[model samples]
Target: MVLAIAGIFIVFCSVILIAVSDRHPDATEGISSVPISIISPFQDAVTGSITFITGIWRHYFYLVSTAKENDELKKMLSQAVEKKNQCIEIELSNQRLRKFLDFQKTRMAQTVSAEVIGKDPSPWSKTVIIDKGRSDGIRKGCPVVVPDGITGQVVSVSTYYSKVLLIIDRNSAVDALVQRSRARGIIRGMSAEDCTFHYVLRKNDIRVGDEVISSGIDGVYPKGLRIGYVSGVIRRNSGIFQEVDVTPHVDFEKLEEVIVFITPAEYEFEMP
Candidate 1:
């Protein structure tokens, strides 16, 4: 009974549609009994509506996914950059600590620690000023050294400031000995990168890479402090001495801080 009722309802709606189409013949122009032209338009409208709604949903989903990916990538890049800077800072601190330990082991006679606060700022002068001054027991002719070796001498001093004449200065001289061979010579500041060792007997045993250190005989610099490594040796033709060039241990271009050995007050000079 239910099927019979539904079939009757469908047939009744179809008849009404056919009567309406008959009243408007253009709506059924190509069909003989049914309005196919009207049927086509309705079917096309339903499909187009579905496609428009699906396109809108697809665009919305794409926008949301792209925003999330962009944020994630930016955060990753930020973390990488931060780690790079941290690594560089750690490496620099490690190098400084190693230098400090080396100085402690040497136990220089007596020492003053100071930071370089200023430079000549002129290409003509390689001078640097240290924070330690005369008030801090610093004076002219005081020896200065870094972990690797000698830097210069304190040439001028005020109550609150001291000027260091770098090993590259023209007027600086130091008595030094070759570490491996125990040969003695007078080293003078010759240039920005090295010094000249004079009064070396041509027959003396010297070679490249020999370490140079303070001789302590002058009572100015304590003996056995490193100065530089030998880089050049020139034998003169029938001359009394040979010329030697040494590369300083400390790099002035990268100089930062230094230690000065101050002899105990009782450590006075003995006249010959």
Candidate 2:
């Protein structure tokens, strides 16, 4: 009975030792897989979340830098545009000055430059004030001209300023002749932009685009100075004279500078 009891105890201990020992490879692997399965997903999730957050932060900074650079480029563009405009203005001013100088050199008469400073307040009188007066050799009846054509004549004078009566004033008249036919007529201003060529004989040949020039008979304007061009002509059977409409060469509204021909005392006295 004693031997049987000892044998049963030995068997029980052997079974416990097998259960506790890591003897079988498959068994060991199975035991280790449970913790790995549970922990691997958590590690992957943590790594993924970290990567996502880092990517978002990097993109936000990139956007901010791009926007700042765009604003800087826009400011540079605005500055370049302003500079270009200034350059264009300077070029235009230079061109005008060159033209004025060329005109001065070509003319035979002595002239002084004058700037337009003001306009006549009276609606009926089409006149402009110049920056020259008696001090600058400007006097009454002095002819004012531009590169295009005659503009006006000085009507009043002061110490430092002079008033010019534009040829378009109603009270203004000029002796002119048609360059094509040498037809003589009196150009009378009826409005600010309109003039009538009166006393032109109906038999005289008058056509549109015919250049009208000073006849030098008035003793005011020089001979052959451009006055206007014939725009229209009207002939009537009952009237002895033909009516001709003329368009002036000078644009009074755009006048900025003028050349005043300084007439001698004899010429000024001869003018009526």
Best by lDDT: 2
Question: Could you give me the TM-score of model 1 versus the true structure?
Answer: 0.57
- What shift in Å separates residue 10 of candidate 2 from its native position after superposition? 99
lDDT of each: 0.76, 0.79
In order of appearance, the predictions have TM-scores of 0.57, 0.58
Candidate 2 collision pairs: none
lDDT of 2 by residue, 126-211 (tens): 98777677778877788898988888788766666677888898878899999989999898887569789999999999999999
Tens-digit lDDT track for model 1 on 146-262? 998888887666555567888777667898899998889998886567889989898899999999998978667777788999999998798989999998888898786799765
The lDDT of model 1 is 0.76
User: Could you say which candidate leads in TM-score?
Assistant: 2
Clashes of 2: 0
Off by over 4 Å in 2: 1-107, 264-272
The RMSD of every model to the true structure, in order and in angstroms, is 40.0, 43.8
